[model samples]
Target: MFLSGFYGHQAAVVRGPKQPFLMETIRVDPPKKMEVRIKILYTSICHTDLRAWKGENEAQRAYPRILGHEAVGLVESVGEGVTDLKAGDHVIPIFNGECGHCPYCTTKTTNLCQTYRVNPFKSVMENDGKCRFSTKDGEPIFHFLNTSTFTEYSVLDSACVVKIDPNSPLKKTSLLSCGVSTGVGAAWNAANVQAGSSVAIFGLGALGLAASEGARARGASKIIGGDINPGKFDKGKEMGMTHFVNPKDISKPVHQISIGKGGK
Candidate 1:
């Protein structure tokens, strides 16, 4: 099967913002224990993708790497000893897999799965913890975020593939793989927002809107949104924002807006 990937020989090399992505053909390795080969169908560009392309996150990145995190695909093959999935099963690739056996996974406090903790810059998908992708000429290429969904196919651990309904739209569901989950999790899982409580959200981007939506879904009494741009205020109001504060127009400090509400 054909696969897609990008390579950067040099770090911090500014390719124009509108630079077109280059595609390459490569062979995918067979999955090892608890691993699966996925035939990717849909992937999306997130802020992280932009940051990586601009080399803004170079410190945590490696050269000649494949970059992608959000994805949805179908299982094309499974590794030995894998039981829960088989070929043809539909799945979503979780950028961060949760190893149920780990203390952090057991607590379910966050998606930071313990067993998969390998430095992306220095590691690839080798069973012995080494690089997996290499050029025909033998130069190694690093795997980005494990999922590498930009490719038409991906090899991922079973922990990273969550089975979902087969009939679900792959393109739309792909969003839930990262952006949707991150935004929702930050509100319910991280902040633990309570129902009928008053809450104020900063920034009105996708994350902020998701937070506001979560609060509204949780029965929050009031949701105040703060943004430097007044243009976003109208959209924020449409998304259940009870109050919109333009930081520039305020006479007093922004912190005072939350005054007497027990906030610092």
Candidate 2:
């Protein structure tokens, strides 16, 4: 149940790289200044989470870390100075947050927030360089990404949480927190793909599929996707990829397929 102070909750904790995720009772501290405590209802795994779980990067191997980002949750409570969100609000966790007042956030040319950009190495609250999660014995557990949804309750900076429609399907909207956003953002924001253009995507994973979908939404004439998996071609086609190139079958460089300077 939600309360005013330390909340005891269940969490999947990993003590070491490649170690099993042990479901344990963890003590979660209440939100700090400009932070909010969330009751995570739905969380999805992304490849980025896997990489950290496997300790592929030295920084991610920070033991006893709660590693997850893509999720939808309800605000359990709000901390001091938090105005945009409150208890009972449905929200999504954003690894890269926009502070709203930052010059980058104020300008239309970029979406990055000056103070709260996505930092994989960041494992503590911005207000104070410390964690809000701890083991039953009071051993501090590090955080993963900005949104550590592996636990039942996670404390996030107010900027990292975005309020969503109360009636929205959280299971579907959960995709927006990571892979889907990464892919769509690439096509729509980074590339600024113009209509009737040819788009070539190197990978056909969830990110690639979402990118193809975004390109399709923008009226791209051709969307060419390259991947080692032949099984993914059908799904890619369904997502608006018009052509598929198997790198295993192609003997020459894939980029020589006549992409214009304007192509993404």
Candidate 3:
């Protein structure tokens, strides 16, 4: 048997700056066609999760919503038409799976597919044009970002499950599903970093480090990382950063160090 919390009627409020997460439980529906049931093992905290919890972007959030996105799990069941994944397959949930046949997916312009419309604002059941999860009392709870990993178990589209090597550590691979993929893909695919080119990364947090790593892996000749924190400088250097610029001290533009002729 699978379990999940269903978000009921709850007032939204931002608790505090650092401590923003509001704990609550809500109901979620079962998987529909092309969806799958996952038994969540681990999930990671992300800035998006914190922001949504804090009500920083409350207008976009639904009440009693499950907020975590980075997650790893084992497939407990598969919906009809899902032939690729089977029961007991270890996978990482990808919130941004685009329908491969869409225009954006065809052009590789964006991963935001047009086919699937799993609304985060409404109860998962309502948006799918049917109900999958309901409170024991029959109330509906919202599913955030299609894959509500904050809960113990979640029903998600098959497109959201990326089957990885079962031997891989779920804890580490979970990070790759969202944060690592976003930062890395942004640098390599979005920015189109050429080999032997100079790259400047704006932030040095996990996303920034991932971007730097992506750039380095692509054979960037010079990778300059900038951050406000002085403590992160050493770690940035160890991560293939050729130069560290503390924006608080540097008066010149960081793009000046770019090896590319055109500013990116």
| Pairs clashing within candidate 1 | none
Q: Which stretches of candidate 1 lie over 4 Å from their true place?
A: 1-20, 57-59, 117-122, 234-238, 251-264
- Native-to-model Cα distance after best TM-score fit, residue 170 in candidate 2, in Å: 1.7
Candidate 2, superposed: residue stretches over 4 Å from native? 109-111, 251-264
* Structural similarity to truth (TM-score) of each candidate: 0.79, 0.90, 0.82
Residue 183 alpha-carbon offset, candidate 2, angstroms:
0.4
Count of clashes in candidate 2: 0
Q: What clash pairs does model 2 have? A: none
Tens-digit per-residue lDDT, 36-68, candidate 1: 888788888788777766666457656666677
Report the candidate with higher TM-score, 2 versus 3.
2
Per-residue lDDT of candidate 3, residues 36-73 (tens digit): 88878888878877777766654675554566789898
Ranking by lDDT: 2, 3, 1
Best by TM-score: 2
Model 2 lDDT, residue 58, Cα: 86
How do all the candidates rank in terms of TM-score, highest first? 2, 3, 1
Model 1 scores worst on lDDT over the 10 consecutive residues at: 6-15
lDDT of 2 by residue, 97-189 (tens): 888887898887335677788788888889899999998788999887788999899999998999999999988888889889899989999
Candidate 3 Cα errors over 4 Å, as ranges: 1-29, 117-127, 251-264
